[model samples]
Target chain A: MKKWVPTVIFLAVAVVLIVLAIVFLPVSKSVWVWIAALLTLAIFSILYRDNPIYRIAEHIFVGLSLGYGLAMIWHLALWQIALRPLFVEGRFILIIPIAIGLLYFTRLIPKVSWLVRIPISIALGLGSGIAIPLIFQATIFEQTKASLVLPEMFAPGNPWPGIWAIILIIGIVTTLAYFFFSRKEKSVLSPVSKVGIIFIMLGFGATFGLTVMSRVSLLIGRVQFLLREWLGIIAQ
Target chain B: MKRRIPLTLTLVLGIVMMIQFFIPHQFSQDFKNTALEWLRVIGGFAFIIGLASFITHHYTKIKHKKEGWAYSPIALGALVVMAVVGLIGRSPNMNWIPVTVQGQQISVFTYLFSNFFTHMMIPLGATMFSVLAFYIASAAYRSFRAKSLVSILLLVAAFVIMLAIIFYNVLPLGDLGEWLLSVPNMAAKRGILLGASLGGIATSLKIILGIERGYLGGTK
Candidate 1:
């Protein structure tokens, strides 16, 4: 019932586990394995109830993640992609982006925070503009093209592909129609949309199922790590 | 003066990038690359804003002795330690503060950085995500009741997919499962994709044309 009880229990268990691992496992991997196991257990503690150990693990994860991202962006995006080209490669034209990027520092000054929008607008505009044709190409053209039935699909005794193709196209159209918000109950889209809703449900179900399996796989991986590597209970 | 410059700049860059996509000449290709590089540079700077915001939040929390303020110090400390190690050590070629580990000459920063990432970060991150399995199961038990035909369809699809994948050797629904996904699932996904793409393209055009000014920060 006490607040400190969880922390004490976690520490006591961690100490025992580390000592046990060090005594049994290879010395080189023992320390890291035990530490990882401890962290894993700490995260797992949240499943039962919110505890100090879980909080510590959660905070540390957030901190380390942000730090990793920060360093990565600097090294990859800034140094390699942007700065090196400008300073070392004598690409002075990069000064345009450099100047724009410098504007981001204006956020620190309350009066000139609006200046930060310059860089933002540049990024947003370029990204949006680039996305327009690319989205159409990737999502619309390619997907529609793929949905079309080919002669080779029904070639030779494999006529099942033709039926499946018709079914797929029907599913796609009906699904799209279901999303047609402006259709009246008396309209042609009404019946089509009704069929669309069924496909949507099936899609949702499949997606949910797939998501659960993925998460379970992740859980299985961590469990295997604990059992095989740290505990040495399972064969390598 | 304030809004016009950004709006005009956005319009020019947007038009340029869009036009460059159509023109596949060496000059146009080079222009696109240059624009992307510029975007990357500016994007890198954008991260600092997030870093600053995070630090400010924790700093304020600690300063005011807010609820659970005790954890803020740990969060901030871990962030600083990881950032310092990562910045110095992660870069393979930078080789700051060189040290030998297991016959490899590497920086102490790199050694510590990698250990933290591998041991601390990976376990913590993976476990955090993995634990969601329990919550999802709990949610399914609590709210995923099959009271309607739609709900039953959803349950059947999810159950079939899970059963087929997890117990592929035991279940004979492999072909059916695959069909369900490739046919019905693909149909719905493609439908959603088409709609979303249209909306996204429209929004993008709106932003480029200065019609969507919300990102400019004010209603004005």
Candidate 2:
């Protein structure tokens, strides 16, 4: 009865809000807008407590996304590349790929599950091979090159750029030293590594601040949707 | 036979793919394209297997009347409805189904798809993420306590960044926050990126050389 009381009160309040939205809001005529507004509220209801309405909306979201993705994959990939070429265009060469792709289904059969490894091997091998050179080129080499600040940064009058460049170089060295686990804790690199940790913490703090801001913005958006779009309580 | 063949395929294909990156020949490009096309088709089949697994899992839960069993039917119903609408609505040239409503030349399937995605999916997804705001606020309160020198520095940095972002013109902390981000933060980020990339390359090489056989499953 205690749980039921809150549930009943919440529902009563929700009904009142919906009634106000329909009667006062300009967008009341658009059925889609009302649906969207209700769905948004239903999702937000999870904050109060898990209920059947929120669960239903959550399940539907997952199912719809999965189904939409499958339909797209069929039309974009399987039909276009494998089926159409093999049947309509009479490209017999596609049969090899189609045959290999069929091996992916061998997982459903215990006796022939080993066949699935072939396709997995091919995919893993290609993906890893592609990643190696690209990762090196993009992250390691480029970042190292960018870190090498030029002497021109120290050119006359503009001391701030030079100071920043020096600080960055020191921060990079210390951060790398911190990650280098090759040496003992009592070694000469220990102090530098400790400095590295400070920079890392500062970086993490900035990241957390930015993340909080982004999440708050999303909350603000939903609030604006409710107040301005649904209830017309706030001016545009 | 099972293990040896797959490992050999990994080794050969991995080397070929790596070498093809350096090669500028037309044959090499064609080989890469064919490999990509094969990967796409195989990926589609993999997605089907995943979908089958999802449906089977839900069906089993419903059969056993599990804790959240009541929601399974809604999920299954939504999947079927969306799949039917998306597949049928995409093919407007089929000319079998009526594609007009109330004198407006609109595909009903397309309209349903757009409505479901916009009204149902987008709102739900966006609101779901928005719930994180309250949780993040609570977490920040618990974590931002100044216990030591390092913790104090971290808390100060966070406060500065947050204030700068929210009221850049009102406060002079924006330039300080920007400086912190561009210099020290960027340096640390670059260092981490370099280390991770090196680690990734090592793992990729290990996989290619068949040292990482965990991906082959525990069958053999």
Candidate 3:
């Protein structure tokens, strides 16, 4: 038997099923619905095994994604900001950034490859500079402020909220200590890091469980589409 | 000459941007805004450059007639077709070809472009992510052994959170899960965030000061 035989049989079956589906399936008015439903099934096919149909869908997704991004850049940014300003509006100053942007292509030319660093440096400088003060304010200062105290502490006859706030603070302190403490310094209780480990584990586990559930929800949504939109077996 | 100029640019730009953040002057704000816009413009070019390499990779595969090379044409074809359609065809006034679909008059190019996103992109994207659900469960089953106190705590937290979400209204576990997230999870998150921000700020400072020239791609 030829290796191509399985592929041939699969294609033949797929074509026949598709034809039958077109004829017998309770059709929606929009052709895109059918296409989307078929693509969804193609993606779900990965659960069974990797095959040509899944590969085709995956490649199409990649191509379309890049194409979409490229078009948006052209339409929104490059066109509105750079091209129009350079051409129609006669704002010659915009050429500076466009020229810098074009320098990225210099990477392909080894001798001028050093020029590519111009853009890289600019990007890196911009990103790093912008990140510093923002990170300091948002992540460090704000988070510290939040964990330091809560309005719950002021609630009369409710020690639970105050306790919760205290626990959160301890959790933060111990966790920070865990981050700061050297491995050699981590004794049972002296280093304050062991308790941090427990909280970290708990946090990780909760995160994983939440991630799994989110995936499950996606699966449910696809299944719901198949049943409701494709098969017309379930109501909207 | 090559390294010095780029390094100097990084230093100047970084320091200037940082200093601009502290200034409340109108000129400072405008300078910051224009610099940000320029950054975005350059970022777009960066993306296109990345895509150029992507296309070149597939081209190389096809040129060499490498394994699974037959699929390269499909990938390239879709990319070119979508891009061509998006560039010239998505215009509202571009109904050169008379195409009516299900009683709506639409340009064939515009229709194709819109349909590619709606039919092709969303379905594949969502389903691709959902496919990971199976693998995650399989991996969890294999690794989630409750051998230690930490592992036990992990499993307990996982089960508690999962169960709480699944039967949120029916069980008291909802309150427990919410409290766990608010108190312990928030603590862990804030702790990690604080540490990371400090480290990140240090790294940024290092880069701004040109102590980290690793991005220049050579040992000087």
Candidate 4:
């Protein structure tokens, strides 16, 4: 009875909300909106406590995403790349890809599972090879080039640009120096590393604030949907 | 033999792909395109393995009657329903269970998919993430204590950023917050990115040269 109390109370509140929504919502009502609101509430019930309703919603989400991904891959990849060319266009060369793709299913059989490594190796190799130069060009080279502040930044009337450029250069140097594990923290590197810690903290703080704001906006969206769209309590 | 063949394939393919990036010839582009197409097909089949693992895991849970096993059936049922509806609805000529709503023709499969995705998936996804707002607040309260100078700096920076975002018009700290982000934050981020990229390049080189044989299955 103790366990059932919360569930019963939740159901009663949900039923009352649904009834209110049905009665007060605009005449041009979307059943989808009602279902969405209920699902949102069902998921939010996890905040109160772990219950069967939240578990079911979570599991259903997992399964549905998997199914949706499969359907998209079937239509987008297999049909377009392999089947259409093999059957409709008489391109027998597609047999190579189809065979390679079929090797992926060999993972299901214990003895032949080693065959799965063939495709995996190819994919990983290609990915690694392609990423090496790109990462160097984009992240390392471009970022270092951008960090070099020219003296022209200080030539103009507006001095904030030059000031910010100096701060950026210092920040980048100190942050990089903090990660230098080759040498011990001597007197010279000690203060620089401390400065690096400050910049790192500031960066993380900004990231956390942005993340919280984003999550809060999502909450606000659900609240707005519940109030204005579902309950008609607020004017649109 | 199994491991050697795969390792050789990795080395050869990695070298070819790397070289192809430098070559702007038509043939090189065509080769890359064909290889990518093959990769896509293989990727699709890879998901089948994932789906199989999912089903097996859930089936075992339900079979053992584990705690909350009742929800397993719901999940499996949803998976089957969504898959069937999505696959059938994607076809252009799917005429089964046709219905006209307000003079527009639509299939039952399409309607089911729309309802399932918009009502079930979207709301669940949004609400799941929104729940993090409460957790973030709790975490911030616990971690924002100013015990040391570094901690105090972190707390102050976070407070300034949050306040600036909420009351940018009412307050004058927004410009300072923006400057902090664009200058020091960006610099630190770029430094981290440069370090990570260098590490990634090293790992990639190791993999391509067959020094990292981790991806290969266990030896017989």
> How far is each candidate from the true structure, as Cα RMSD in Å?
2.0, 2.2, 2.4, 2.0
- Per-residue CA lDDT of model 2 for A133-233, tens digit only, reads 77877888888888887888887888788888888889888988999999997999999999998988888888788888888888899888877776667
Candidate 3 chain A: worst 10 consecutive residues by lDDT?
A: A182-191
- The candidate maximizing lDDT is 1
Candidate 1 scores a chain A TM-score of 0.90
Model 3 clashing residue pairs (backbone): none
All models, DockQ values? Answer: 0.83, 0.71, 0.77, 0.75
TM value for model 2 = 0.93
> What TM-score, over all chains together, does every model reach?
0.95, 0.93, 0.93, 0.94
- Our model 4 lands, by Cα RMSD against the true structure, at 2.0
lDDT (tens digit, per residue) of candidate 4 on B134-201 = 99999999989999987887788777788788888864788877877898789788777877888898
Per-candidate interface C-alpha RMSD?
A: 1.0, 1.5, 1.2, 1.3
For residues A1-236, what per-residue lDDT tens digits would candidate 1 score against the true structure?
98888778877887897687778865336577778988999899887688888898889889989989988998998888877887889888788888899899997998888898899899988999899999988889999999998888887877998888988899889988888788787897888888888899999999999999999999999999988887777888
What's the ranking of the predictions by DockQ, best on top? 1, 3, 4, 2
Q: Against the true structure, whose DockQ is highest? A: 1
Deviation from native of the Cα of residue B83 in model 1, angstroms: 1.4
Residues B138-201 of candidate 3: C-alpha lDDT, one tens digit per residue:
9989989999998998888888888989988865899988877788887888888888888999
Which lDDT tens digits does candidate 4 get at residues A138-182?
A: 788888888887888887688878889889988888888887777
